[model samples]
Target: MNKKRLLAAAMSVLVAGSMLLAGCGQKDVKQAGSKPEGAAYKFRLAESNPAEHPVTLGDKKFAELVKERSNGRITIDVFSGAQLGEEKAVLEQVQLGAIEFTRVSASPLGEFNKQMSVFSLPYLFDSEEHMWKFLKGEMGEKMLNDLQPSRMKGLAYYTGGARSFYSVKPLTGIDSLKGLKIRVMQNKINMDMVAALGGSATPMPAGEIFSALQTGVIDGAENNYPTFVAQNHYQSAKHYILDAHQRIPEVLLISKVIWDKLSPEDQKLIKQAALDSVDYQRDIWAKTEKEAEAKVRDAGVTITEVKDLKPWQAAVKPVIDKYSADFKEALDGIDKARK
Candidate 1:
């Protein structure tokens, strides 16, 4: 009986030792982005423009980079053409964490973060180069960070090219815009800008702009060249005035709720990917802008370039001066960037 007991005890000890050794040999996988090993995460990105648009393409590139860097651990699905919602509605969804990501015009964001309205000021940047320099610098970082309080985090800025007025009638100069009803974004700064320029402001969503112009609900609207072509606004509003008034950028944002849940490493990785995609977007945007200009001209659309902008600048100076106090820091930073 004693011999049998000794043999049984020895067998149990060997089995226990083998189990411990097996565990030691196993690799440890740290949880990333609150996800477990072999588990993948999927996110949705909201883009109001069509798939072919530069901003949408940029978002896709960002997703591609993230998926490649994460080795299939993370994937993002982009819903273009406002499949998720219009700009404002999508932004609200992002803030509530109902959606994961979105790329929206910085103009509309003024409703959420007052500082964002600074971008809407007429002639804020001396040139596209000046605008990009400011957007990629420290002040830009602060402006992006300012969205945190609104329950969203700004990821990166995409080029909006230059915003200009296009109308059913010829927009020859500041005098041409007088008394015309201009469609503007749903923000006070844009409304005020239209008002300051001596035009009646009609606030509406992007999707509604084409019909509004066709039905004579609005006389004109202001946006980048790419938007004018992509949205087919040039079909109805045949006159484009190249005043290059505002170069408001489009901003990518993630829900703060979702951002807080991501691992620090994952957050850093995603931000770097977003920043890298900016170059891709900017390149395509330049090419597209040129193509759009040619297309519009070929379509018999009247193109008016204001060589002397002093008159237009003077006309909108009151709009800028009125809001200067509210955005002193931004204005100061912009001044520094001009140099």
Candidate 2:
């Protein structure tokens, strides 16, 4: 009986030791990612791009990193393909704190922060490297900080390559675009840019473009390569002119309402995650653009490269002049950014 009692006591002690070791392991994992004594945070990110889009993939990567770095303290849920609503409507929701985040083009974002329209200015970026150098510098930081008053915070920028003209007929030069009715975003800058380039700018909804092109309601529309192929716009419009106009950066925005609620440490974690996602998205953008260009050509679209950009650049001079007053600071940044 004494021997049996001794064995039972030894076994009980060993079990308790193992249980304590297991608890310590859990504590270490929790400490790596947990916020200090707070409830878990869950955020929703809205994206209008398609599910397979690089933007969407980047959004997922951001969420994944946040999860890993936070040690499960915070989780970000992404809603893609405009699952929330249109950009303008969703932006309003973000301001109201009904939504937490969104990925928006600099064009529609102009409605929230007017200076953002500067990104839509034609011929602003000489090359991708030039644009990125500016974006990763103080000027871009100011642009992001500019959103605070509007109750949003700019997190990061992702590329969608450059916009160009696509038509059922060839757009070989500035003269070739004359009298052609081209679809532009429903924005003053975009409209004026197209008009200055000699195309009759018709601002319309993106969804209407395919049928409109088919029925000859409009001559052509302009967008990036992925959009041109994904929407089957290549089926209706065979000529894609690579003028590389308007290389706008897409911005990731967070609701200030939600941001204010986060712990400083958590905010830092999220911001770093967002910045990391930018590189991932850019790589995806390059790959997607190359594949998109190939697919559209396989579908028999004629892709035209602009040999002389001097003529194209000269055409939008009036547009730069017209918005010179309101966006002067932004315009100046563009020139300075080139350096």
- Evaluated at residue 323, the lDDT of candidate 1 is 88
Top-TM-score candidate index? 1
Candidate 2 TM-score, C-alpha based: 0.86
In model 2, pairs of residues that clash are 33-70
- For residue 73, what is the lDDT in candidate 1? 66
Best by lDDT: 1
Model 1: lDDT of residue 208: 93
- Per-residue CA lDDT of model 2 for 13-114, tens digit only, reads 355335434544655435533454344556678887778888788888888998898778677889987887767767777775667779988888887789
| Model 1, span 217-294: residue lDDT tens | 999999987889899999999999999889999998988977886777778878898899999999999999999899
Give the root-mean-square deviation of each candidate in angstroms.
13.9, 14.0
Alpha-carbon TM-score of each model against the true structure: 0.89, 0.86
